[model samples]
Target: MWVKQISVFLENKSGRLAAVARLLADNGFNIRALSIADTSDFGILRLIVNDPARAYQVLKDAGFTVSETEVLAVEVPDRPGGLAGVLDLLHDTGINIEYLYAFVSKSGGNALVLLKVEALERAVEVLGANGIQVQDYHIVHQI
Candidate 1:
């Protein structure tokens, strides 16, 4: 299964990030997880929210650049070497991970990892075969 993630492009300046967060909060959207990758000029704010469609539209209406992406939310064991084990499986299967961020699940005991990978279908298959749980979008939304 694939999760819907929103990527918001933010200019590098003071209060830009807070302004975006305030907008989302005022719109009643709950942020499930987020990560930011930045350079000197701009940054990419990747977010898994309760409502992707509304988030995208609100951000666009506010004159922010936003886009949606299909990513995977995987259940990783919340124990030693859990993440390494998952990575090893992907590596052995030749699935390249472009980027990833993680958060502890509020309703579960496992850590949830949001991953962007090349060949999403193959990666899902490999993970499923290896007994890793790839979460559905609906489940993630509820989180």
Candidate 2:
């Protein structure tokens, strides 16, 4: 399943990150996952929140340059080369991945990964066909 992800363009300043976090907190948004990529001048903060659409609106209204993208939540095995094996499979299947962030949950033996790929639907189909678990928003949020 596809999930909505929020991406905020933030200045490469210290307080800026805190400001975004505070805004979300005050607005009653629960963050499920987050990844930040930055340069010397600015950064892109990617977030998977419980309410992505609402968070996007709130952030935009708060004057943050924000956008929403469709991403997928994938479950990777916890053992060694687990992620690598998945990547290899996608590569062999001709799928191009844009970016991904992963975290190994304490409750489950598998690792949860959020992936923004070049072809969303095909990746989902390929992963599903190969027995890889694709999670919906509710399942991801619960983690």
TM-scores for candidates 1 onward, in order: 0.97, 0.93
User: Best candidate, lDDT-wise?
Assistant: 1
Q: What is the lDDT of residue 32 in candidate 1?
A: 90
Global lDDT scores for all candidate models: 0.92, 0.86
lDDT of 1 by residue, 1-143 (tens): 78999999999999999999999999999989999999999999999998799899999999999999999998998899999999999999888999999854643778899999979999999999999899999999888
- Model 1 segments more than 4 A misplaced: 104-107
RMSD for each model, in Å, please?
A: 1.0, 1.5
Q: Clash pairs of candidate 2?
A: none
Clashes of 1: 0
Ten contiguous residues with the weakest lDDT in model 2? 102-111
Which lDDT tens digits does candidate 2 get at residues 1-143?
Answer: 68888999999988999999999999998887899999999999999888788899999999999999999888898889988988887899998888999744632677888888979889988888988888877677666
| Regions more than 4 Å wrong, model 2 | 104-108
Candidate no. 2 TM-score: 0.93
